[model samples]
Target: MDSSDLAYDVFSRQCSSRSTLEHVTGRWGALTLGALHDGTFRFNELRRRVDGVSEKMLSQTLHALERDGLVLRDAQPTNPPRVDYQLTALGREIAERLLALIHFVEGRQGEVLKAQERYDAARGGL
Candidate 1:
C-alpha cells in the first residue's frame, strides 16, 4: 500500500480507546503495576499485595501483561513450580507513570472528597 493509503487505512478503524484505558486504569492492572514497582514478586505475594484481586483475575491479568511483553515471568523448577514476575523495561516505564498518577490522586484526595460531597449534596437535594 502507498504510505498515504496505509495512513488512511490505519486511521479508518476505531481505536480501542476504551479497552486501552481499561487495561491501564483497570483496578487490577493499576494495583499490579504499582506492586511490581518495588521489585519482583511471586504469585502468592502478588495476590496478597493487590488486596482485592481474585486468584483467577490475577492469573488472567498477569497472562495479558506477559503476552504484551511488559512482564517477565521466570519459572523455577522445584517440588512445586515457582514463578516470579518482574516488570520488563517497558513495564517499568509504565509503572513509573502509574506511580505519578497515584501520587497525583493522593495529593488531591481531600479535594476530590470535598467535590464528591458537594456533588452528592446537590444531587440528593434535587
Candidate 2:
C-alpha cells in the first residue's frame, strides 16, 4: 500500500493505527517496552524488572510487541535454550518517547497523588 493511503486517524474504528496504539499503550506494553529500553533481557529478567507481571501476560506482551515489529526475540540453541528480547530500531524510537512520559509521571507522582486525594475527598472517597 502507498504511504499516502495509510490511515492516520487513530480515532476511526477501522484505522489500523488504533491497534498499534493499543499495543504500544497497553499496561503490559508500556512496562515491557520501558524495561527493554535499558537493554536486551531474558524472559525471567523481564518479569522481575516489570514487577507484578504474570508469565502468561509477559509472554503475550512480548509476542504482541514482536508481531508489531517493535521487539526482536532471539533464541539460542544452547542445551537449555535461551531467548532474549531487544527493541528494534522502531521499538527504540517509541520506547524513548514512552520512557520520557514515564519519567515525567514519576517526577510528578507526588503532585498526582495530591490531586487524586483532593479529587477523592471531594467525592467522599478514601
Candidate 3:
C-alpha cells in the first residue's frame, strides 16, 4: 500500500517486537531511556545522568538507539561541536514504558534484595 501501512505491518511483526525489546531492555538501553525521559540532553549530559556508563559504552548504546529510530541526534556546528539528543515520538513512547518498568523494578527491590540474601547464604557467598 503506502509507507504508513508498511510501517504498521513492520511494527506488528514478532521480529520487530524482539528487536525493539532487545534495544530497550539491555543494561545500557534501560538507563539511557530513563535518562531521556526527563528531556533532551547533550551527549555529555546523558553520560552523566546514566551513572556508571563509559564514553564508549554510551556512544555504542546511542548508536543502537538511533539506528532503531528511538533517539534523535542533533550535531550543531559550534566552537566545540555541540551535540544534543532527544527522543523521537517512538522514543518518547518507549521511554514512558521504560519509566513504568523502572518503577516496577524499584518497587520490587526490597523483595529482590531479600531473595538475593537468601540465595547468597545458601550458596555460601555470604
TM agreement with the true structure for every prediction:
0.83, 0.94, 0.83
lDDT for residue 14 in candidate 1, whole number 0-100: 54
The sequence of per-residue lDDT tens digits that candidate 1 reaches over residues 9-115 is 22334544345445657888888988998999999999999998999999988887777667899999987999999999988998899999999999999999999
Q: How far is 85's C-alpha from truth in model 2 (Å)?
A: 0.3
For candidate 2, write residues 2-120 as lDDT tens digits: 97777599999988788989999999999999999999999999999999999999999999999999999999999899999999999999999999999999999999999999999
lDDT on C-alpha atoms for all candidate structures: 0.84, 0.96, 0.89
Candidate 3 residue lDDT tens string, 1-126: 764565433355554656767789999998998899899999889999999999999999999999999999999999889999999999999899889989999999999999999999999987
> What TM-score would candidate 3 get against the native?
0.83
Name every residue pair that clashes in candidate 2: none
The alpha-carbon RMSD values of the candidates against the true structure, listed in the order shown, are 3.8, 1.3, 3.2
- Between candidates 1 and 3, name the one with more favorable lDDT: 3
Compared with the true structure, the alpha-carbon lDDT of candidate 1 equals 0.84
Ranking by TM-score: 2, 1, 3
Using TM-score, give the best candidate's number.
Answer: 2
